[model samples]
Each structure stands twice: as structure tokens, then as C-alpha cells.
Target: MKDTAKHQGLRNQLVSLLEQKGITDKNVLEAIKKIPRHLFLNSSFEDYAYQDKAFPIGAGQTISQPYTVAFQSQLLEVKKEHKILEIGTGSGYQTAVLCAMGAKVYTVERQIELFKKTSVLFRKLGIRPKYFASGDGYKGLELHAPYDSILVTAGAPIIPKPLMAQLKIGGRLVIPLGEDVQIMTLLIRKNETQFEKHEFGEFRFVPLLEDKN
Candidate 1:
């Protein structure tokens, strides 16, 4: 649970690498810098936490690579106090980033072990998301509909209709869509029935599963 000066130095290097890879949003970068990513991984993986790579965090899921987190966060254009819904709260790394940027995050995770473990981690780190639930993300959190932005951290075979319907008008939903290798996609809700779509290359993630554990 220690975030040493050495860990901070490593994060600085990682942020520089992210900048070189075209992550231009300062807010995202700052959030990435502030969060102690090493604490989110198993102790054995702490040394590699700042390497811009994904690591398994039990339950057959992996914390997303740093670049993917930055890219998806940038696409959402998150603002202070934005009501954000995040699917797949794997290690709570993404949720912490959103919270650090001042978004009121409502995140859901299907893996029970991760959901419970990360819930504790959030409290220990003082990263207060609006809500965190153990559930099937494909359904979206309908109880809290109309989000300012939605971010899906895992690969999905299709854009889940429930998630699309939950977005506020002009809100963005950033997701990685595909089976094997996912395409990073952004969908902006134009109105009740229309969305503007864009794609930004490929990323691989653990598949977004259907039911709760």
C-alpha cells in the first residue's frame, strides 16, 4: 500500500510515454499521474504497474492498458461533475481516474471477487465514485439513466442497446467493440434515436460478460 517516490517517478515516465503516443488531454494525464496504479495490482505486479500495459487482476479479467484508459477517457471529453457510467470496474483503476477528473462515476463490474476487492480499495484510497455495483454491465445501470458519458472498459461483440439508450443527448459512449481484436469506437448521442459514430483503431480487452458472478 506504499506509493514511494520511486513509484511517482515511474508514473512520470509513463505519462511522458502516453504524451508521445498522442494523449493530449491534460486532465486525463493529470488524473493518470495522481492515481497510485501500483496499489490496484497484486503486490507482485507493483513494479510493472507504470509500464503502460495491462495486468491480470484475478477473476479472468485484466486491468486495461494505460493508453487505452487515456484514449477512452479523452474520447468521452469528461468534465467536472459529469455523470459518468463505467462498465467493467475490473481493478477500479479507470473509476479512480474518472473520479480524479471530478466526474461522478457509477461503475459496474460482473466479477464478484473484483467488485468486492476493488470496493475496499476505493475506500482505502479515498476515490469516491457515485456508486459501484456487482452486476451485468450489458444491462447498464438503468436505475441511474441519462449519463453525461459512458465508458465500457472491456470488448463487446455489439454495442449494447441498453447502454446506448441510457446516454444523455449529445453524450458520448466510448467502447471497444469486437470479438477477438476490438475496435475502439465512440458514439455520440445526437438525439433520442440517433448517434454519431467514429472509430480509432484497435485494442484487445477481456470480453464484457453477461451475468453477475
Candidate 2:
């Protein structure tokens, strides 16, 4: 009973926060509220879960802030049956959001420890994604090719070609680009020959490195 009440309070606060930040998608807001962000953190930091800041989860990685996760998820423009590819699983908060939105998520985490940790947490949270891979190969999840949307949480100097190839025609890719600082970018496939690109704004994220563990 106490646990349910805590979750409800957190949900309400998160919904209010999302609204203040202009996250208009009701589905997205509901997903954010439904997923328990505290489950992704260590017990000591669980109390801070409702706060809207990135918190460290070891391995030099941080669970992305609620706004960033919501912002990225919104940019993906996921459909009810969209097959989504996530480049960095991190703490799996973003993946949870995508799954909650009714998308089939294929997520890859480069760190084995974080990957395994998040996998167990996902089971506990009951936010099952379509695929979860732990290891170095994060170019893209090609086995399940032609995803409707691809979201890269890590900021990369250049978008990985494999990820671009995995997108079906008319699919969308949202990633953060540049070094030192980053800008969130949205790319839409306009047939095989070209892509339409849009820059969202300045953002800060951990550099997306090729960690082949």
C-alpha cells in the first residue's frame, strides 16, 4: 500500500514536471509517470528519483534526466507499433519509456555491468523490450532490420552508418551530434537517396564512444 502511494505521488509530480517543460504528448507523459525512475538507481539515490536531473549509475554513465528522455522520446514520434532501436541502454530508463509507449524496443548497452544490471531491473519493472544485447557491437541491431525509429542516447561525433542502414524507408532517427557540446538532431528518411535533417537545439550529453566490451 505504501509503495503504491509512493509511485502515485511520483507519477503526479513527473506529469506536472513534463507539462512545465512543454512535453505535450499525453502518451509520453503517461509513460514517464508509469516507469519508476528510482528502480534504475542505487538505493541511496532512490529518494532523488523524482528530481529532474541526471544521476550517476556508475561506469561513468548517468541515467539521463527526465526532460532529456522525454524530449528524445517525443522526437522519435513513435507509433503504436513502431520498432525502435536504442543505441545506449544506460540505466534503461529511456528504454522503459519507449516500451511504455507501445513500441517494440531493441536496445544495446556497451557496458556489460550496466547492461546486466538494467536487464534485471527491467524484469522487475516488467518493462520488457523486444531485444537487449550486452557487449561492444552497438553499430545497430541489424538482426531485426528496418526499425520504424532509431534513438541514440549517447552523443556521437558522427552518426553510425549501420544505424542509418537499419532504418526502413520513411523511418526516423534522433541523435545528439557534435563534440565539446552537442545539438539534438532529427533525421528522416526520404527514400533511399536522401534524408531530411533538422536541428532541435543545444544539449549536453556524455560522448558516445565505441566501447567494444
Candidate 3:
């Protein structure tokens, strides 16, 4: 529960490594540095939490590698109080990162096992996302539609249509598109009917399951 001086020191080192890897967003880096990632993992994994690698949390999901988390967060260009929709809550590390950045996050998780576990963890950690749902990620939360940003943490076969339609104009949708290995894709909503697409290399992520309930 306590983030020690050693933990902060390791996080600072992680930020330095991310900078070397071309991460330029200071806010993203700061958020990463502030989040106590070890608390999101198994106690045995506490030693490896700050490394630039992903570690399995439980179920089939992994707490995303620090670099990937920072990269997606940087791509979104989050501003204070921006309404962000997170498609995969996973370990709630990414959720905490967005919350730490002052974004009002509405996060959905399909794995009921994980959703149940993480929802409790969020309160214990004092991280309050704007909303939390245990259901399909493909169907964006319509009640909270028109988001300022949408971040999909898992690999998707295609951009989920409902998510795109729910985006506010000028909002950024950052998702990875693929089966085994996903290509990070960014869609900036230009208007009601169109989105500007850009692909940024490749990343590996657990598949974003459609319906598991």
C-alpha cells in the first residue's frame, strides 16, 4: 500500500528509459512515474514491475508494459478533465494512469474475474475512474458517449464501430489492430462521418474478447 523511496527511485529510472526510447510527452511520463505499478501485480513480481515488460496479473490479461502504456497515453494527448473511455481495464494500472493525469475515465472490462477483482482494487488504491462496467468492450458505453479520447488496451481485429461512433469530433482513438500481433492504430475524428487514420508500427497484446458473459 505504501510507495517507498525505492519505488519512486525505480519509477524515475523507468521514466529515463522511456525518454531514451523517444517518449516526449512529459505528462505521460509523469503519470507513469507517479503510479505505483508494483501494487497492480503479484507480490512476487514486485521486483520486476518497473521493467519495460509486461507481467501476467491474473486470468489471461497482463498489466501492459510500461513503454506500451506510456506510448498509447502519449498518442492520446490527454488534457486535464478530458473524458476518456478505456476499453480494457485489465489490472487497472492504465486506468490509474489516466486518472492520475486528471482524465475522467470510463473503463470497461469483459473478464468478469478481472472486473470484479480490479473494481475492488481501484477503491483500495484510492483510484476512482468516472465509471466502471463489467461487460463487452466492443459496445462502447453509449450513456457516456462522445468521449474526448478512447483508448483500447487489447489487440482488436478491427476498429470497433460503436466506439468510433461514440467519439467526440476531434477526439483521438488509439487502438491496436491485429490477431497475433497488433499494429497500433490512431483514428482522429475529423467530423461526424470521417476519421483520419495513422498506424504506428506493431505491438503484442491479448485479444480484446467480444462477449464472455
Candidate 4:
């Protein structure tokens, strides 16, 4: 529960590394700095929690690598109070970053084990999302649809159509698209029937699962 001076120093180093890697969004960087990343990891991993790498959480899901979280977050262009839909909650590290930016986040997790663990984590950290669900993220959180932005944390074979339908006009969806390897794809909603697409380089992520838990 304690974020000591050593942890802060390591976080500073991580932020510096990210800046050198071309992450220019200050808000995303600051959120990464402020969040106690170690708190989201297992006791065995606490020592290297700020090293910008992914570590297994539980239920076969990995807390997203720090650089990946920052990259997708910057692409999402979070605005204060902007409604955000996060497809995978994992250890809730990324959700905490969104909360730090004052975004109203609706996060869904497919693994029930992770959902329960991370729900308790939110209480301990005093972070809250607008909604949290332990269900298939492929369906998206339809009850709270039309988000200003949607962020998919896992690698998908193709963009989920439900997620596209839930994005508000002029909003963006940041997702990694592929099977064994992924290309970071950003889709911007232009109108009801049109979207602008862009692809960045490759990334590796746990596959986004459907109904199977």
C-alpha cells in the first residue's frame, strides 16, 4: 500500500524512457508516474513493476506492458470527463490511469477471477470507474454505449463490430489487430457509416477471448 521514494524514483526513470521512445502526451506520462504500478502486481514482481514490461496477473491475463498502455492512451486522446469504454480491465492498472485523467470509464473483463480481484483493488486504491462488468468484452458494454473513446487492451483477430457501433461520432477506438502478432490500429468515427483508419507498428498481447471464461 505504500508508494515509497524508491518506487517514485523508478517511475521517474520509466517516464524518461517512455519520453525517449516517442510518447509525447504529458497527461499520459503523468498518469503513469502517479499510479503506483507496483501495487497492481504480485508480491514477487513488485521489484520490477515499473520497468515498462508486462507480468502475469492471474487467470492467464497479463497486466498490459506500460508502454502499450501509454501508447493506446495517447491515441485515445482522453479529455476530462470524456466517456471511455475499456474492453479489458486485467489488473486495473490502465483503468487507474484513465481515472487519474478524470475520464468516466466503463471497463469490462472476461475473466471472473480477475474481475473480482481488480474490483477489490479499486476499493483499496480509491479509484472508481463509471461501470465494471465481468462479461465478454466482445459484446461491448451496450447499456453505456456511444462512448467518446474506446480502448481495447487485448489483441483481436479483427475489430469487433459492436465496439465500432458504440463509439460516438468523431470519437476514436484504439485496438491492436492481429492473431499471433498485432498492429496497433486506431479507428476514428467520421459518421454513422464511415471511419478513418491508421496502423502503427507491431505489438504482442494476450488474445481477446469471447464468451469462454
Task: For candidate 2, give the lDDT.
Answer: 0.86
Worst 10 residues of 4 by lDDT: 204-213
TM-score of predicted structure 4: 0.98
**Residue pairs whose backbone atoms clash in candidate 4:** none
Model 4 stretches astray by more than 4 angstroms: none
Better of 2 and 4 by TM-score: 4
Query: lDDT for every model?
Result: 0.94, 0.86, 0.95, 0.95
Task: Return the number of clashes found in candidate 2.
Answer: 0
For candidate 2, what is the TM-score?
0.94
Tens digits of per-residue lDDT, candidate 4, 78-147, equal 9999999999999999999999988999999999899999999999999999999898989998998899
Per-prediction CA RMSD (Å): 1.0, 1.7, 0.9, 0.9
Per residue, candidate 3 scores C-alpha lDDT tens digits across 1-213 of 779999999999999999999999989999999999999998999999999999998898999999999999999999999999999999999999999998999999998899999988898998999999887999989998889999999999989999999999999999999999999999999998999999999999999998845
- Enumerate clash totals for all models, in the order shown: 0, 0, 0, 0
> Once model 3 is optimally superposed onto the true structure by TM-score, how far is the C-alpha of residue 88 displaced, in angstroms?
0.6
Off-target runs (Cα >4 Å) in candidate 2 are none
73, model 4: CA deviation in Å?
0.4
In terms of TM-score, how similar is model 3 to the real structure?
Answer: 0.98
TM-score of each: 0.98, 0.94, 0.98, 0.98
